[model samples]
Target: MIEVIGLTKRYGGKTAVDDLSFTVRPGHVTGFLGPNGAGKTTTLRVILGLDAPTAGAVTVDGVPFRTHRRGLHHVGALLDAQQVHGGRSAQAHLAALARSNGIGRRRVGEVLAEVGLADAGHRRIGGFSLGMKQRLGIAAALLGDPPVLMFDEPINGMDPEGVRWVRHLFRSLAAQGRTVFLSSHLMTEMEHTADHLVVIGQGRLIAAEPLRAFADRGTRQRVTVRTPQPAVLAAALTAAGASVDTAPDHLAVRGLSAEQIGALAFANAVELHELATHTTSLEEAFMEITAGHADHLAGSR
Candidate 1:
């Protein structure tokens, strides 16, 4: 588990993360989501003790990460896949990290094969593609076989197969009762991968909740109904306190559920063709919550 309390970071006059407090528990894949400048990376840096917080505290399990006797054996992280020596082979890089952390050199081969990079372990990192570099980075993280994992955009530059493999890997890790925290800007992939979410905007917390609960928090819920007698059904729905809008061949209804709308149509003897509820997607809800929270929004003057 990871615990952060009243976390704040400031660079001179600018605050990057402000009064953030959250706990990432075990047995779940928790996603850290934010726009480009929302301070996701800054918070991760603080968690891993790469950067100190101006105020507040962050701990992995029970103590600050840097204070751990066997730091690499307790937590593993992949902040930047490209932050490795270009001249070194994949095996050499993992070997060096293992030696530094008092880990066994034999673990290097195990993780390389775990990440599907066993054959490429002897190749120079300079010759690897972006996707291969990502795999190599993951191999390094797992070299410790740590219980806690933190990754920043692990799927970046990955092909479809690689992306799918990563999704499954996260799930498998969490199922083993490990803590998995990943930061990403890809909402679609997150929707399928994360069990919980921590959303931030402009250096503050927007929401921290389960994925299903967060998506259901969307304010706009509508029921779509198709009927030949649109006018009659619309009148009945309006009388029941529902706002209705006309589409090409259906009525878009607010303030009601699909079952409610269907029952109203049936009581009014209206012929119904189709009835479905349209709940907001994760991307739509994310955009709505962070509407004006972006530090750098793109637009033409």
Candidate 2:
């Protein structure tokens, strides 16, 4: 489990992370989300001890990472996949990390295969494509077989196949009861992969909850009804306290469920062509929540 309490980081006069507190529990995949320059990467760095916090604390399994005797054995992370030395072979790279952390060389091969890079382990890091590098980074993260795993944008450069593999891998790890903390800008994949979410904007915590709860927080659930009698249905729905909007051939309804709308149509002996509920997608919800905190905004005078 990873616990962050009142975490804050500042560079010179600028504050990157601001009084952030959240728990990444075991047996779940928790996604960390934020807009650009919202301090997601900075928070990850502080948690991994790559950067020092100006205030507050972050810990993995009840202990600070830097103080752990075998930190890598307790926590595995891939904050920057492309930071490895280009001069070394993939195997050599893992070998060096393993040696530093007192891990055996055999475990290197194990993780290489686990990340689907067994065949490319002998190749130099410089020659690997961005996607291949991502795989190699994940291999290193799994090298220690740690109970806690953290990744930042693991699918950034991956192909469709690689992306699918990563989604399955994270879920598989969580199923095995590990704590998986991930940060990604890809909302669609995150919606499928993360069971919970910790969303931040402008370096402040906006939300921390289950994925379903977070998505449902926004006011975007609307019922769409298609019928030949659009005018009749719209009037009936409007009179029944539903905000109605007419579409090309459908009525977008607010403040009512599809069941309620269908019942109203049926009560009036109206023929219904289709009825469905359209909840906002994760991306849509995210944009709505972070709109006020966006670092850059556009406006026309």
Candidate 3:
């Protein structure tokens, strides 16, 4: 579990994090989200103790990370895959990390195998592609055999197969009872990956709740009805108090059930070509929520 209490940081006059507070519990994946320069990286730095907070504190499992017994073994993170020394072999790189942290060589092999890099362990990192670096970074994180894991944009710079693999990997890690904290710019990927979301904007917390709740709040269930008498159906749907919009061959409608639309058509002796319910996609919901916040902030600005 990671608990952040009134975590704040300031660089001279600019406040990066303004008295932020949140609890990241284990047994689930928590997503950290924000736009560029929205203090996400700074917050992660504070949490990992790489940068000191101006006020408040962050703890891993009831204690600051520096104070934890086997601190590196308790929390593993892959913030940047490119942070590796380019000249070293993948195996040599992980070996050095294992040695520095007093992690055993056997565990090194396990992690390398775990991330499917066992064969490439002898390969130099400079020669590896972005996808390979991602795998190596993951191997480094798991070297500690930690129960808590944190990743910042773990899926960036990967092919379609790599993206799907990472998604499956995160899900697999969560299922094994690890506390996974992920920060990704891919809203749709996050929607499918994270069990909970902690959204921030302008260095302030915007919303923190179950992923579904955030998505649901931005979408209204709508029904689409198509009819040959499109012009006729629009007026009838409006008279019926359903919000109606004109589609080329259909009436995109809201606040009406499929049965009601069918009944309305039947009563009016109207013929229909198509009738369907359209569920809002996750991307749309994210746009609606974040766009609303942006507009609100701009209005004030």
Candidate 4:
């Protein structure tokens, strides 16, 4: 239950986030995706109040974060994995945090176990590996048992086993009616973990909808049309307002449907042809939507 409206942030002459708006609903895992410099981190900063927005507003559960007396009880976040003190043990670290927040000591152990870090609770955080630290940060976030959770690249340093564990963890949390908002550049993880997706680019919102909805706009339908005069068939189809690109052995049509192109060929006194249709992939769909930003990102180098 979070809403960001017209969220704009700037640094010097560069706009980190420009008029971004979106809503995170309960009972679902919403994936926030974008290219490297697409203002994802800045948006999170504005939402968390880590950085004030130049223009716009963000609210948690319909109230501004500053007004909630016990705001953290309803919202938990893991902004960075390395914020823990290096020399302190995991238990001590969580205990210290719980004390400041007036949370019980028992919650420390509960979150430790929940994050699969119970046995490592007494170990020094400095000695812990990257993945272990990530788990520890997650344990801290869950210590409050909040209804809303925000994680920025939770799987960044995780191994395959840890990644799979987090996948199930987010799903289970959302299934229990929690709002899980995650921002990551990892497309594969988003494909598996996110029921809804909010994608942005160039500091602006791009598409926000069910993952399947964005994927259904793909243009990669494969069509195979066979004709006696292949060259003439290709030319006629191109003239009939179809994007005719030559394959190694066949023709690829982009705009016009195979049926329409075939009919045009027939009208032009062309011979009959065989046609077959194929489907594209979710990854392809993502690329198509972010193509302009992807190209710009590439050109920046």
Candidate 5:
């Protein structure tokens, strides 16, 4: 498990993280989300001991990451897939990290195959495409077979197949009782992959909860209704304190539950064909909750 408590970091006069606190437990894929310039990179750097926190602390498995002699065996991370030396082959790069962590060379080959880079291990990293580099980085992170893994945009340049593979890999790791902390800007993939979420905005904690709970925080609860008598149902729904948006075939309703709508329709003798609730998507909830915290907002052209 990873625990970040009262964490704060400042660069010169600017505060990047402000008293942030969150726990990433084992056996779950926890997603980290934030708008641009929200200090997510800073927090990840501090957690990996790459940058010192101005205040508070971070610990992986009950101890600071830097205190471990074999850091990879305790906590493995891929902050930037392109940070490796382009001169080295994928096998060579992982071999070096394994050696530093007192891991055998055989583990390097295992991880390379695990990441679907067995055929490309002999090629130089500089010649690899962005997607291939991402695979190689994942290979390195798994080299030590650590119980804790942290990845930042691990699917940045992956193809559709690669993206699916990563989703399965993260879920598999969490299933094995490992602490998996993933940071990505892709909300759709995150909604599929993550079981829980830790959201931050402007370097402050906005939410830390299960994915469904967070998404349900969105205010736009809607119900879709399909009926043969669309006009009758629409009028009945509107008169019962619900806003109705009419369509050619169906009506989109707000401010009423499916049960309540069904009951009202029955009372008004309105025949119904379909009634379904549509909760907010992860993207919608993210936008709604962090609408005010975005540092960079785009204007319509």
Candidate 6:
């Protein structure tokens, strides 16, 4: 588990992260989300002891990450796939990390195969594509088989197959009772992969909650109803304080639950062929919640 308590980071006069507090528990894949310049990278750096926090504390398990001798055995992270040495082979890179961390040489081969880079392990990283580089990075992160894993945009540049594989891998890791924390800009992927979410904007916490709950915070709850008697249903829904958008074949309703709508329809003797509730998507919810927190906004054309 990872604990961040009132974390704050400032660079000279500019603050990056401010008074952020959240706990990433074990046995769940928690997504870290924020708009550009929202201080996500800064927070990650502080947690890993790469940068010092101006205030507050971060700990992996019960202690700071810097206190661990063989850090890889406790926490594995992939901050930047492009930060590796391009001149070295993938196998060589993992071997170096293994040696430094007192890990066995045999683990190198295991992680390479685990990440589907066994065949390409001997190839120099300079010749690898972005997707291949990401795979190599993932292989490195798993070399120690750490119980806590943190990935920043691990699926960037991956092919569809690779992306799917990564999604399953994160879920599988979390199922094994490990702590998996990921940061990605892909909302659809987060929706499918994460059980919990930590969302921040402008260096402050916007929300830290379960994925379903966060999505439920969206501004609108709409229900789509297809009925033969659209006008009758519309009138009934409007009378019940629902805002209805009428089409020739359907009515989009707000401010009422599907059960309530059905009950109202029954009371008015309106025959309903379809009644489906349309909750907000993760992307839609994020946009709505962070509408005022964006750092840069494009002007109207």
The TM-scores, one per candidate, come to 0.93, 0.93, 0.91, 0.84, 0.91, 0.91
Q: Number of clashes in model 3?
A: 0
Q: Which pairs clash in the backbone of model 5?
A: none
Query: What pairs collide in candidate 6?
Result: none
Per-residue accuracy of model 1 over 6-112 as CA lDDT, tens digit each: 99888877788889889999999999988788888999999998899999999999899999877789998999999999999999999999999999989999999
Off by over 4 Å in 2: 296-301
Candidate 3 per-residue lDDT, tens place, 195-218, comes to 998887767787888888888887
Clashing pairs in 4: none
- Evaluate model 6: give its lDDT: 0.92
For candidate 3, the per-residue lDDT at 2 reads: 87
lDDT of each: 0.89, 0.90, 0.83, 0.84, 0.92, 0.92
Which residues of candidate 6, in runs, are more than 4 Å off?
227-232, 269-273, 296-301
N/CA/C clash count, model 1? 0
Q: For residues 219-254, could you state the per-residue lDDT of candidate 5 as single tens digits? A: 588999999998988888889999999988899999
Candidate 2: tens digits of C-alpha lDDT, residues 1-301: 9999999888876788889999999999999998888888889888899899999999989988999877779999998888999989999999999999999999999999989988988999999999999999999888888999999999988999999999999999999999999999999999999999999987889999999888888648888888999998889998999999998978899998999998899999899989989889999999988889887212200
What TM-score quantifies how close candidate 5 is to the native fold? 0.91
Scored by Cα lDDT, where does model 3 land? 0.83
TM-score of 3: 0.91
lDDT for model 2 comes to 0.90
Error of 3 at 42 (Å): 1.6
